[model samples]
Target: MTDTTVLEQTQLPIGDWEFPRLEPRGYVEPRNRILKRTGYYGGPVKGAPSTSRQVEVLNQGILESPMQFEGLLSGVETLSKTPSVNDQFQAYALGLVDSPNVVEAGDVGVGKSTLMKCDYVLRALTLLRRRVVVVDKKQQSPTEPWGEYTNVAHTAGVDPIRLALGDRDGSRINMLDPALSQTRFIAGDTGALMVLQQAAALLNDGTPLDTWERKALRAALRDGAAQARARGRVVNIYDVLDHCGVISDELTRQMSPTALERMHEAGLTLRFILERLPEEMPGLFDGETSENVKLGEKLTVFDISQLPEDGPAVPLAMMLANAWTLGTIRRSEPGWKTTFCVDEGWFLVGGPMGKVIQSNAKLSRALGLSNVVNIHHISDIPADDPAVAFIKEAGTMHLFRQSKADDAVAAAQIAGLKPGAAEQLMTLPKGQHFKKVGLAAEVRIAHFRSELERQITDTSAGLTGAAL
Candidate 1:
């Protein structure tokens, strides 16, 4: 038989099937198919205008004015409206930010850092009437975003105080200051002991003090506080060490010989750690706090920009700054909103002070405090580290452009993002991020900063030749 005749005999007979009726001979439609000729089974109609989503979102309502809360809005702060990524139709309206904690993660140049700094810091200082403390490590030169923002802060009556190492005339924070110690001294001896424990923890980099070390340090701090009280002087670290250097005979007799021996050894080790820290890290924390170190109606920048990035001083400074800020806030009148922001917070959260920052984060709301923490990558944080819990507990998260697949995955998991978010992270253009507030669906935000804000927060001023 001829080839053409054979093919025609084997193929199914031609039929007029077009458009909606077009289907293969054996094709079958499943009963559970989501898309139908009319519309999606559970969603909007097929080929509906882009305005549909906008109408749906707006129908839910725009943010209520902060005035609605009146008395309860005491520490509530208002931020610029969060705009939707694209204006194909209408933008989704975001409410004023009142969350106790905000965590942001992204790769470099993705704009997450600038967004939080300009938005949160500006709102906190101006609108919220809150004292702000920022541990800034990114201002490498005079034109950097933080540096320019400092100028803006200065003009706004919020003088920016830069505390850098070796700047003797600049701000200083004495971790061993007696007044600072007294803040930790709660109920007399109990409080005094706690202060000593903190000192031990600080010196040991947050590892728990050993039993013998604890006993010895507590005894010494207890005794030193008494002596300082008698002399009308503040008890400093040296005094505690001095007390340890000579364990009183009466106290020594009370302990078993082995316990006494343990105390003696622990005292020496503690002394070595404290004494060596000053020698190793000189101008940062070795003296009385600078007289200029005041948190008065201004933004206090713990300008550790001069310190080496990988050195131990950064984390230590963060710990001291956190302690100092907490104490200052507690001493202030109640109902004042205060925001504590840590930029490049890996130093604070991924270091020995992680536990300190974590505990402070938990007590933030009760204390009328707001903690804003930023890091480059979620995967950089160890899974079991205390910081993981801190990141997870945050009420708001801004997930910016992630450069690595693993980082995107970790960010998604930590933020409890939708499964598709992992893939979205890979393709997100710069300056756009996925923001999730509490259990709400993630919103795509195209952050809009004013010209003034741009001038104050442009990190690429040098490369772009942008003027302040």
Candidate 2:
């Protein structure tokens, strides 16, 4: 009682105190000192809130704009909700791409072939109503003995033009066929002559023809064409082979003694090479293009899977088929678009053959054609090769997983991707790729497929035992 009375006398008055008194342990305030309020209440509010303060207000300009890839190719599983939709024609029309050319590079079993089959071939035909021609090199399987696209072509109600060495029933495409020469696509006789020279070079182990060799080859081709026209038939490789070593008096008159000797030697060497080509690659480029090798269908598959991988047959077949397809397209009426898909594109884009592919790519837009090249990796192609220029000129590129560090870096560099993209490319999962269209920034895309497409585009028949 004495302590409580002394404390109470020492406490200051509430109104006179500068600060609230500190309470002791177990202290309780009087009921009248405690503040109380009823349920819910608001202070007097003034004017309406400003638009900037409203939750619904948004800056439309700052919002991310959607990508305008018009054509529906696949679903995009990136940050954006837009589907991964684009084809060469639509991208070109939308001004999103400069050239109607596409390239796909990645490691094997990473879905390059599937994309080619689905997007470039099947979807191209069904969705866009465009024509597709596939230079199929991969064998269907160990038991099928046909191209991987054999079933795809059959699904489209057409048969693949199969080319096998020494098989009399196999299809043939004369590198010297006059149909290629007649169409001014790559330009008349000059185009045919180029094919011949390229074939000779391929036979010569990728060494281009020298001045003398070129002169000899040109003269022989001219003579062969004239002879074929006189005979009222198309010129074949055999016609050119017959005139290879024959030096006319005009050719002899134009050359000095030493030059004449060199030209003669060149002619003989070229003849020897051309002569041995049929023996080496029997049934190919030996006769006129087979009657069955027609582009009557919306899709045409030149099955060159039977050719030896390490030899010149693959490249020769690709070159001839490309030339033939271009000539046919040039002659066809306008408004219809075509896509030429070449798998194992390294074979077509190396050495002299690369120049032909490059020329075709340059003329892609004018001819209403799209060139789709599928290769293993950019690192596999030589840095100095002409294919490098063709690859760099592509308006669209699909980069899949590159297991090798160098390959990933090369893919990034070739596609002009930003920093850290190489690392992403190295780790990209199967069916996922980085798509770079024209000058736009590369976007990470996860390719989606339909159930029907999955069955038709499956290339793992050997592994999974799935029927196409």
Candidate 3:
């Protein structure tokens, strides 16, 4: 027989920060020094290093030792004169190391991405020297670390490189110089390479492709073998391009008033311009995916910034799905942990990328690959979004503010707070926010960011210049 036990109720403790303040200075040498001059988000440093071989990344980066990292956190509190936050941050990082994921939430201008970029991520990467995978649908700002990661890699004695947006040619091989052969761009329409090749061929051959022909050409885009098989393939855009040929730069410059009209009349939809993208150039929409993984030393960047103006959220979802699947399948041996840091998680979770991220979510934890996802709004996150499974499973989050009405509602619900409070939290005054600690703890705190970090991250001001 079991004895009935009485449960004791305890009052939640509230405290004034009345403990004696420890004397500042004299503990440790300055450990947490901010290295960057600008506060804005900039990618990796360019011209950092070059590689000679394909890197089989068996381990992640090493910019920080665990002890030093903890020390750095403590130093941050020192800089701000705040109470020791080491325990809180340590708990957060511990949760991340265990689960390997965290969500940053809050209002529009509350510095979600910036916090990720500056407060923690860059230093971690610097410590780890780990290769990074940045999956952001937003324009690749020149200021962010993604672009300069290659330079970081180079400086760290790792052959890191950034592929030009459309590095993959018709063959899907990341095309870059032997020196800059450390980066791999794996996003979008890489399969469309040969189709464009075929269209260019057709154009060279003097054949014209109507809309139906364009569709057929799309088939050719998927596979070079299929493209090759089309010997007498009904001349489409490729044939037309082969025949009329690309307008010479001089011709383009001397185009008469009627020339622009004639060019437009020639079925030059923006898509066609995209479809007939550069074969030799390095940026978005270069070609198809190769069955093989990083072949040479090229750091390839697949620039889909030119992707049809439709919201990239869905397509991005699809791309992330296929990309990780293919990359993982290729590298599924032991000791292979791929860390993927994805920006704008909310959009992909509900769209095409959901299945891709979901299928791998549980499996990756075992593989040592941690997916850190970022999102702009809570509403953009679907109720059953697969990423949520990982987000919950990973059990660490950095909730920021949300200013939008719909987003506020969703954020409020997820944070388990009064619905009305969500809106206020979303519109929280600068430097203040409600941070939800996984599913267990919640805190409303004043947030702060370096001034430089603020200017680059300020979306309201509009991007000052071309992003990488």
Candidate 4:
């Protein structure tokens, strides 16, 4: 049997050609190693990407010393099918990026949706050398398909996998290893999965949080909780989950009667979460769900666009569980390299995600996970301090085009420049973005679109679908 894992890492047998020296990634080097861990936000620190920026050859460059070498250039012929081209697969074989995490920042319509394009990620897959896992939101429809591959690109080495939210437990996703089943599952209609997961854990561990942690979580779970308390007004479910994370109106319809009944029987109809994540939150595919969150050194994109406007409730649950399970990698299992990336990361931030990122960022490295998060804007995130800290620790950042005024302002403020430092922000063209690393010169990235856009419908699967 062709080992899909091995297949994912194989390189395109296309050349004796020299790869341009990776331009000095410079200061971001420390953070660059962030995504090397086996999974989730439990690693040293840093990160990777997609698009035209993912171009394989220099479309144009001054071959400094245009012919300092004469015979070095022959009538260039592609290295057709030799094991030599697989050199790039070493990292995967060596277990470099077992699970990868990431967070992207940009306003709506500016390609935040476009960021996870498969083409670039597939190119990156060649280097990381690991299986791919996709966690898109739970929706009524299937994910945008990405089927079909040019016989050429396939041989060139584009390996990947895709999974949808509606999947039953133990269902095999296209690119992910079937063995890579979720350890736990968290479920909720509201975006309070994090709170519930933590609440569940805190209860299990029998550890109560201090006042500050409670305050942070309350604020995170509900948008109007503080104001309600301040004004002596009533705070309800609508205020916390719905209004805050833009909770789903549809969730009301989808709420399972059996689960609700079970919850009531358990004497817990709802859960409230605050700061400290649980020791662990496990998942069950039979449908009794908990937040099934896991991290490893593989590129994991949790796309929430399909969810109701409320954002992702599951991540909170996963974060809570992770806070319990993987948090002890230091005492538990050392020498693991990992990176965690959260796409459209609003829900997790400030609520459960913010707490996890905050508690783990500085220390995760030794345990083998580096954390990277993507947000549409600074305001979308809940924590003032942690949000800024995450941006800084990310080492390398990409600023995609955004249409939001306030979010744009927040992005600039977090960047820590004068009032107008983000002036270029307004002028950014579609699919064009800005990039920065720890003290590295801020650069621009022109997202290279995957031809997959065309195959986003039926008949197209992995390399083709475009989720809108």
Candidate 5:
């Protein structure tokens, strides 16, 4: 039947409303109509007309994801608007870094020391309740006659353990003190022998002892320690010096007549070096470790600022201080963490002392210690030096502004920064630094300090003539 006939017959009325009559048309298959309808809507839609355009196009590229850091330290604002907040220990605890050791490098007056004093030392003590041991090398001022951290140490309820050259009343640290050998890191005679070798190296203008000299020094240390124990006393450098020339039965079995003569001469030389130490730098390393050099408080500052910059006195004191601190920490019960900070760290990480620091850094985690080394420039240290290895071993780095382009490049390279980070290091303003935590992308951080912190952390008082 036709569509019109069908529609007319099916139409019905209800309450005077009848269905409209259907229009008659040629019949086509349903597939053809469906395909035609699909083609019309499948075409692309038109763009907005030119006259309807109202806003300018934003063609700038997209930004990267913001970085995030979390910890219990002071907050630092980042360029990406996220807070970069974590100390070395905190970062290590979070697995963001593999080692808790940190190296802070920058030029002078760029806030490296200030950040260390405030964020690492102060905050760690007050907030985390961690102990800190600082080998402070900078003087308070030319006229102040004390280390820069003297006031900070006092604030932490402890006096700075002052060491001075030719000052008879200054504190003393026995190079052969029994406590140095009492630590878990270096047991019995091993620790005392290491200290003696370091002392000999420092005294000889950074030249290490030859095999004969090492043998002589080791034999003397062993004999001296044994005699001191017998005498019911702890050994000192003087005791070791007295026993250096005493050839024992063990020496005869160890070497021929000619070798024995060379060994004896080497022992005399080491003895001479030790004998002259008291006259050269009096009251240091000549007696037992001072009663005042106790790590009884949360903060201990070894004020070695008065020692001459050109001599071995500074590094010698630092070495002893480090040994004493490690021995104390090792003997203490586990679960108590400590932060070991060395400002002007170049002194602590050069010559034979570098080996000591490297060893300590390797065992820092086992001892619950976070080692922090603050230096002015990595360029100052030769690339082949052992200290360079120690610097590289630090998993976290805070790089501040560097005055020289070479220095900036050296620091950036050591920190494994990207190509442009070296330029960033040169132009970074004061209080802003590039912080690289482990293998994560480095962040540009602006370190913020409150007024109280500013007052306490100020190292510019010497230059600015400001009150401490």
Candidate 6:
């Protein structure tokens, strides 16, 4: 009933089934047609701002806009007579410009930390008027930043305040000031718990407390805090120790028989631990926080340089400093930027303080702050660590010459560089680094420091002076 034959037009092929791609068959006449490309070119285009105009906009953004920042210094292209477009220069310069966190890694003698201090941190302090808190852990060597950088800090009109633990003359930082604890608690921070944990860790050689011990310690701190409040005074660690020393019969009666038995043992163990802390760390945590320990200075350096790196003192000082900084910043006006410098980051990264540092990194942008973590190598950070998580959240990374191949490869991976770039990283000269900033391609920067910065940053200055 229906016509089964295909229509003549349908049978006629309009095009070949397998249309071959156009292949050049020798010389052919070139046809002239406008290509429709959809991308930006080097020069000005239809609806985009020019290079200089873009720079102007970026500068304007620095004032109050939500635009990203460019670098502190601009780069000059040397290969071509015509300068590269300023927009490209801005992008290249900002390649390693950090948002709120920067991770700088390299081997010894590679000038990684020096370059960061001289170039970025100093600029932030002097030009941007950002408050700086440095955890100075470098030992008393010719290259120690605490002593050597004093001149630079003075020149910047910042009288650097130093806190050296265990030094009788040094500023005292009480970790258990009830005022600080109560204020932070009222502000919704983990104040009482953090303080209790810090005290236990410092006492237990950085080990976590058992469940019963934690419960007992928490109860004692609460009671001590209440007693201190009644007397119109702030409680210290010693107050908690005193409360634990007298594990009250009234308090024990409220608990079940099993819980009471464990609680008593836990209280005794905690007392034993707390009593020995003052002996183990004499002149450091034995008394109230000194009046000299204030954050009103432009630069406050917790100079734990005298403390042994392998000991608990350094990390304890770091935790205290972290607490102080966070509380002070919380009270400060929002919009004022602060630079928190963690020199010799292994103290925080490889230790229990990494959790605090990780928390800081997460709130950095919201708090209008920047955290610089300078370490000798990526491997210094342990695997599956909160420190590693902090590094991953960093939008800026500066990698100096890596002496070890593994370090170079890890650095390359963090910077998102090509596989071949890892080899280049190992071969980079001193003061040169591969930097990545915010969604930008990696750039090689030859950092130049002034004579004063060189004098301030160079460790060999003292050696040369001694030689002379």
TM-score of each: 0.71, 0.78, 0.47, 0.44, 0.79, 0.74
TM-score preference between candidates 1 and 6, better one:
6
lDDT of 1 at 14: 20
Prediction 6 TM-score vs. true: 0.74
All candidates' lDDT scores?
0.63, 0.79, 0.42, 0.39, 0.78, 0.65
Ranking of all candidate structures by their TM-score, best first = 5, 2, 6, 1, 3, 4
Which stretches in model 5 have alpha-carbon errors above 4 Å?
1-69, 127-129, 248-263, 348-350
Each candidate's number of clashing pairs is 1, 1, 81, 75, 0, 1
Give the per-residue lDDT of model 1 (tens digit) for 333-427.
76576678876777765567678778877777566667788888889888889889888987778888897899999999988999889888877
lDDT of 2 by residue, 170-260 (tens): 8988776656764445677898887777777888898888888888888888898899999998887778888987878997888798877
Candidates' RMSD to native: 16.4, 16.9, 20.3, 21.0, 18.9, 18.3
Give the alpha carbon lDDT tens digit for every residue of 7-52 in model 6: 2212212111111233434454343333213333224656655798
If both were scored by lDDT, which would come out higher, candidate 1 or candidate 3? Answer: 1
Candidate 4 stretches greater than 4 Å from native: 1-103, 118-121, 128-135, 138-316, 320-337, 380-385, 404-406, 416-421, 453-468
Which regions of candidate 3 deviate over 4 angstroms? 1-98, 140-303, 311-338, 380-394, 404-406, 417-424, 445-468
> Per-residue alpha-carbon lDDT of model 4 for 33-128, expressed as tens digits?
344454543645654455677674657653222111211111111122211111112222334323222346776556554444332233444443
Candidate 1 collision pairs:
186-191
Best by lDDT, which number? 2
Higher-lDDT candidate of 3 and 4: 3
Model 2 quality (TM-score): 0.78
Which parts of model 2 are misplaced by more than 4 Å? 1-65, 127-129, 182-189, 226-232, 247-266, 348-350
